[model samples]
Target: MNPPNVQYISECFIKPKSSADEDETKQPIIHLAPWDVAMLSSHYIQKGLLFVKPSSMNDQENTVQPLLEKLKESLSLTLAHFYPLAGRLATSKQESPPHYSVYIDNNNSPGARFIHAAVNLTVSDILSPVDVPLVVQSFFDHDRAINHDGHTLSLLSIQVTQLIDGIFIGCSINHVVVDGTSYWHFFNAWSDIFMTNNSSISRPPPVLNRYSHVLNLPFTHHDQFVGRYEAPPLRERIFHLSAESVAKLKGKANGECQTNRISSLQSVSALIWRCITRTRRLPYDQETSCRMAVNNRTRIEPPLPEGYFGNSLQIVRGIAKAGELLEQGLGWAAWRLREAVANHTDKAVREWMEEWLQKPFTYQLGRFFDPCSVMVGSSPRFEMFGNEFGMGRAVAIRSGYANKFDGKVTTYPGYEGGGSMDLEVCLLPESMRDLESDREFMDAVCI
Candidate 1:
């Protein structure tokens, strides 16, 4: 099959419908916390949902154009609550070595970029294939932009592509500005406004205040982490785990460890880690790791508000020797993962923040590119298919071509909506082929 061509229709910057008090001349300059600064080296988080057009639109003369206008209008209102997303990153080198911060000049906000495009493919063209089609990458803007690029580029970019029988809404959010949780928060809010035909969002508004007590240091490592990352040739595939399969894995994990504490995520992570390590054929003595992004909102002493926005994540890892990890079976591996999460307590979070302040460093993608390492991102807990933007619920979810590397895994709630999950795994060409054919790995995967 030929790659679907996306023809651009129009492009515009959609600013917030409402601004801050006009009398205030100085806009708030939000400084980046240690956690936010750590993502300076990462790429934008690109995700999208595929929705089949509502049956009511079958008789409309112009379906997509009107929907595009509605989306843009609702997005403008949504920006009122998430105003910082419409702003840009600013840096001042005069401060000895320079520091980075988000400058929301509401009066002159650049606004989020909105692009309208059309593709000649159906939703099945994207969701039917075992391997996601490369053309799907064209649905998103900022294909290779990193979080640092937010300084010059739009902090957020939304693309609405009109498919033959459906529509795809793709968003590219700066990783430095928000993590996966906040990303979906904004998405849900936008959809709510559109679905209800209300200008104001009914959901919990985002809390924009920075958590200052955690880190009192300034972010001055701008130049140290500025560059474009070129990922090597990689193949991406989504593996589905049914609710029953997940339960079985969880049961097996708990039974082996003689405990019932291992969660479904830990069990799944353990399974992937072991499968990838075994497929890579690493040495028995090689140390392999499974890194998971832990949300710090609830891990701190005084938990940040559920609506608290911005980056508040810490990467925790479960490390074990390759031979021991596979030999111990699934339960032992899951126990290691669970222990990693349990160890990242409030004290551990604060200590890590303090250490980062003293000697600042950013997360380099190379650390996760290690063949023996697997990094799990995104979560099934997110409202993946719940964003009903007046049209309908999302039938499927997909990610764009940013930040993908070997052993990178993104988890999403399956469309079936139970405890089911979809693991979007990226790996080297050869390793992916081996994994597809590996009987042990394929046995747990649901068709």
Candidate 2:
């Protein structure tokens, strides 16, 4: 495929469409929760691009300007409910403290940046398999993609690129402020506002009280965490597991167990974990583990409201020896994954947060490579197809450079409600090459 040539058109700051004049006196400083602070060291922005092909008649009738106008208007209206996205990040002191804990200064209203561009390419050019790294580096805004200093943050920025065949709506959201679910919530709401042309009927008010349970922790811990670690060299690629493959994995996993059917997530994760352990050829006795990110919204006591928006997530890890994962059947690995997930009860989440508060600078150093660990992030359950944004459903979804770390993986559902999965796997070049050639792994993956 030919390299895409993109031309920038215009850029602007988008603020809330409506604001209350009398509410200017409200508290502007939103403190960071311990959970939120842990993400301050995150250098990669959660990047996603949605591809859509408008109907022929609509495509011919609506030019770029009209579509962009509608998007900006709808985005502004959507921001009114998710007001934190419009705010900026700042430290509490003049000079940075040990770990300058950051806060969202809502009073300043930094606003999200919106950009318009035109690319001399087609939807197929990207959707088709290609050098994913080159494509991501070319298309995304890497300069400000991740929060480096915690001193400044765009919070959210969006780019609407007009391709020859269709349009791509790419967005970069700061990880410290929101997770995948929260990001989609804001996006779907924006889509609703535009499609229905009625802000009141589009999205219900998001519950902002979700942060009330967060324990206030010092920001300096962010500096400590960032200072303590350096990322290893890594490469990323997207692999697809078809519905058939996923079903087979589940069946195989279930067959190995006397009872207890593993979930699709556990099945798939177990397959990948076993493959990675085999591909790396780790020693049988070497300890191996999978740290899976779990959503705590429903798991917490008196569960958070469905619309509660914030970073309500925890990392639960399953540990086993390398031999145990590779030598055993699929069910064994799946059971480990399931058990780790089961242990993260509401009480467990609360305890985890408290522990972080007590030792802000601590790191889960064991979670990284000696080539025996993988951190599984995101889930296939998120409704990526629902991010229509006034256009047709997205044909494909992708991750940004933020996922550039060894032993990191992300999963999204296959296209159009399919039960298949798209796994974004990042690892050291050698490990990736080995995994690519592993016959058993390659056989199950969509070619």
Candidate 3:
């Protein structure tokens, strides 16, 4: 049998013909800045679901229908203020971080937005237990395009099944329009507003107002980045952390280190670092970094408002010499990693953010971040994991975003009482083999 096919379908969208002399006209929504279009397109490549059984769901949710209405209304009102970056995706020429417009076919009465391609995910649990259903989903093919005919753009298709329970909705909002804090607030508000009527999402607070629009700001400053930088190459691989291993690493080893403040994530991260350093054969004291991402919604001074959107993020990096990281005890390694992450909310971080926004290459810098870096951060913080229709608590959740960097790890907690952690690590496959071989590191890991 032939291997599974990665399907693709493309269609052209033209703006409504404005006059007899012209065949078609592209809609204004398609003219959004290329930088802005990317903010909307990157969400597609991030994470594929490991659908866990949900506790509950309403089959008749018609969730998308209601959402469509809200989005339309929001777009109209939102476009008035954000036309520079709203409507369809933009089409830019860069590929490391791809960019394209969301074409529109205005010929349709509703001015359907034209997408160049569409991906159909056929969901079936044919190979799984009879009780499970194969839940197919579609991934719109609009990663890169040009001359976005907003009039041709169409609705993004989404489908859910009763057999599956939890979902990991990872979004890649343009940094130009939102930061981490702003994005989550928008997410929280989007959920709240959509879940019920009369639910108002407050406007995002004023965090980053720095914009050059031009290559030159008031006073321009540029510097070379210190760390090794690479782009995150896409691939398919399961981030494996077996149940038995995690338990032993987390403390199944000895009775002495029992009853501690260490969470599974912290313990696992430390072990991962030590094992990685050992596997890589790096000398002690060599400056290596472990980075993690932290959401700043609740951390902003005066607190940002509910609907704030834009890039509000902090890269917490832990650093220690190869010798210190590997030779030191687990507690020492964990502490070093934690301290490196301590900068998650320093005043300097905000200054760095403001400085970055003032940069013309902010997007370019984002594109340069590889997945193989020796840093890790827990993401898709699901504070509201209670939004399930049926099935049961999610058995696991994971993220497989391994950019070109060295050590990339993320942890997602299961639903209440969902015992094991769903840890996702995307590293060079060869390096992973070495990680698995480190018995000392594995023993220190507390799952």
Candidate 4:
């Protein structure tokens, strides 16, 4: 399969609308919490590509010279409110605790990288869901080009790729700055501005105070989590589960418990966990864990504001023996997954934060090679199809990161909608081969 040819037209930084403070020597350096600092060692950046149909000439009197022009203009205006996206993460060379903070030095650093490019392809070609990695790579630069050596920095990167009958909005955001929720918030905000042709619409102002939620960690724990773990070679495959299949899975998961009802997320995650374990042929007694990304917006005490940005995420893991999860049925695994999610309450989040402050980076520091662990990310709640920019809503959406870790799962809303889900599953080549031929897994997935 040949990769799509994407021609890079131009690359320039989109500065904020107001550059009056560019000459100011003293700038704000937003402090980061322990959770934010932990990601620095992992060096994981979030990348996604959104595909929108071609704009109808009648939609906007066709007055907007080009879509890229409007996008850049609106993005400049949008960055005024979300300025952190325009900044970089860095540390002042202090003798004591390296002051790691978001540097908003306007004179020294440009806001975000915006690339204008085009591809010779159609919307249908992308929506087909084949050659996904090739298409994704052509549009987005997941290289994390920004130097993260704590000395040099660049935070966000945006690339607007134009197709024959569509447009692709590619974004690469540093994981230290924002999580999934904040990622979509900035995206939707950009779309809203472009749609309404008004930068002053009723949008939730972003909360930039990184110190608001502090995780005071000990200085000694700084070196505790340092080494970056290498992952095994993996392949990415997208599995679509129809709404009917999801309902059946949910029903089966709930059947195990007479009292508690299992959620769609829990049911779907449990099925993936079981399928991966069985496909890998892991020993029956071998312990495996499913780490689900939990948003702490509502789980935090008093709850964060409506548009509080930053990394407000925590991964909750559900552990069980490989044989136990595969043998016990979907309900049993779902029950365990449900309990893991339920345990992330307001108090639990606070306690977890404090506990993390003690050990800090011990969790993800050197565990990338753990084949027994599956990291489930993304949520159907953030429906990418509903994201309507000035031209049109996104027909297909995908992440650009080549998830190197084995057993990593990312979920998105399927084309059929109505609770249907598309799981972008990544695993070792051998395990993926087994999973592709697994009868039970195939029966549950909608072809």
Candidate 5:
């Protein structure tokens, strides 16, 4: 590629000829949250660079564009498939309307806000530091060619780049329409179809139906819900964690509190709050909350059919204080975390979701809470690592998007020399570094 030139491409507009006209056969890609769609556009346009190296014929360098177009076209056929992996922190209201947007909506960014995922192929011209920004900008700039109305629909910038030599493919999905697995299934299936010229072999039709008849919650009748976390001004640092440190935190928390059903994740999060409070050294009885994300798929009956893409995550928070969470050892915080998660999960959690599932788009989750809230979300339940066509089994796989909130946390079970559970974890950068530096933090989780 010539030394990249950043051009604000000449733009044009199109009034798709009576597109959604009286055509019953044509399904609308539902616009879950127009605000979130816009938020993702603004965020990804700034840093959504996911480099991909061509592997099989479908991903061959010369043919990437057509495949990209095809993927978007297919995805556009549903109402629930607009923005890719976007999430919202709006104050959670009394009801949970079809939550499908995958993105974070904090008004801040000092570090990158891209949603990076890899395809593990080797290719030339992987982006170098100086030019990374330029290449990343190109993907969003060319949105016109991809989806002209990308801005309007919250499906703006996305980068498809070559990583490694030609054995790996990196992709930064604009956290709008697709979440983690949705992108995997979408791209993998697209590759499967393109490689064979059939869009349906072993592919399942996407389930975009959010039937009102099914959501039988006693809603507050049009109660407007604002987001839980308001968009904060960009921070000087980006919030992301590496897999190595997450493992250590889990071990440290375990060392302190040896208990049942106590996930390493909860322990690590508790430790994070504890450490941050200590460093900041805040006062006693000062409360804080960790926004815990829960996937409602398995919890829901019939377990939404495979490939049923949309926002399926729900938030349950772990509450502790500036003094309590801060002063307590890892074990104490971990125990409290365990209780918080467990208490919400009993019988009340399901009913809570049932009701919250019917709220309006502006639903803010913060209205229902306390102090020092840290938002968190997790990657898919199980890794979707078997979409291989020719390259040997995947050697590595993990999420590329960061939580991006001031006190945000998100994780994925890392893949090392693994099977069902050699769990590797990632955390916000600062917290991870703290875990590595502090011996107490380190020993608490037994890292």
Candidate 6:
């Protein structure tokens, strides 16, 4: 399919309209935790959902204007609760103890960017394709901007694309401010405000306070964390695994191990790891790794509040030799992943935090560029299909061109609304072609 032309109609900044009575002169500065600082070099998180226009609207030609008005208005109300997004990242100029903070001076603040665009395409143009169209990347702002760019750029940017028969709402959020959990929390809250026509979110409001235990460390040599990341040429494809396939994988994994502790996620992660290793044709004795992002909300000594709104994640890696991984079958790989997750306890998290303070470092794109490794991000358990903003449930979900590299895999719940899963796999062009033709891998993929 040809790339559709996206005509930008207008753009403006949407400021937060607070519902609470507070002094604008003394807005608190939010401090960044170690987990948050670790993502400074990574790109902004870009995600969006596709919604069909409702049949209740009578005006055809004037529909988009009203929809844009409603979205912008509700976004203002949503930002009142998520005010940090309306601010920018500020760094202290001192050379000794580098300080990074999110500064929100309510008196004078640069608001989040809201863009309105029109696309001459249909819902089928996005959802019906075997591979997601490259044009989908245009639905979002801040194409390749990293989180560090928030120092000069908007911490949050939203784009609402009007299609012929649908709407696409995409967001680019600074990863230093929030992780995947917080990302979806804000999304669901915004949808709730719009759906209920309320000035405040219906769900429990987000806890904006920084974690108390994380020490404010003076991170040196911060120059490495600020810059644009240029990724290699790659191909992105979504592979679907139905409920039956997931169950079969779980059963097979557990059967091989003669235990029922292995979960559907671990099973599927193992399957992808092995398939990618085979497709890459790595040396038999080469050491390969699978890194999974684990949410640390529940893994800490004192659990964070229910809606703790910040980065509370840790990446746990499971390593094995290429030959052992492919030869031992699925269950062994699943067990290795399970062991990795189980080992990331409260003690481990605290130890890592302490170590990070001693030697501060951020995740660079090179860390994930290896064909012999896979980094699994996002989660199938997120409420991807629940963002109903008065139109209907989202028909599909898509992402932009940020933080994408070979061996990067993101998981989402299938739109089928079952236990089905969708894996958005990014790989080199040649390896992608090889994986698509691999019978063992393609057998589990649903059309």
Write down the TM-score for model 4.
0.88
Alpha-carbon lDDT, every model: 0.85, 0.72, 0.40, 0.72, 0.42, 0.85
Angstrom error of the Cα, residue 248, model 6: value is 1.1
Q: Relative to the unseen true structure, what is the Cα RMSD of model 1?
A: 2.5
Write down the TM-score of every candidate. Answer: 0.94, 0.88, 0.56, 0.88, 0.57, 0.94
Put down candidate 1 lDDT per residue, 160-192, tens digits, no spaces.
988878889999999988999999999999988
> lDDT tens string, model 2, 56-136?
423442566788988898888887777777777776543343334467777675588788877776777776763363554
Each prediction's total of clashing residue pairs, residues at least 3 apart in sequence or on different chains, is: 0, 3, 72, 0, 93, 0
Candidate 6: give the clashing pairs.
none
Global CA lDDT computed for model 3 = 0.40
Q: In model 2, how many backbone clashes occur?
A: 3
Q: Who is ahead in lDDT, 5 or 6?
A: 6
Candidate 2 Cα lDDT to native: 0.72
Model 2, position 54, has a per-residue lDDT of 64
Cα displacement (Å) at residue 309, model 5: 3.0
In model 5, how large is the Cα lDDT of residue 368? 42
- Give one digit per residue, the lDDT tens place, for model 3 in 370-414: 332465554434432433212233343322221224465555544
Q: List candidate 2 stretches off by more than 4 Å.
A: 1-5, 19-27, 55-62, 94-101, 130-133, 142-145, 148-150, 201-204, 210-234, 362-370
Model 6: which ten-residue window has the lowest total lDDT? 99-108
Which has the higher lDDT value, candidate number 2 or candidate number 3? 2
Alpha carbon deviation, residue 179, candidate 2 (Å)? 1.3
Lowest lDDT 10-residue stretch of candidate 1: 99-108
Off by over 4 Å in 3: 1-3, 6-172, 179-265, 296-303, 343-346, 353-372, 384-405, 415-420, 440-447
Off by over 4 Å in 6: 20-26, 56-61, 95-108, 211-222
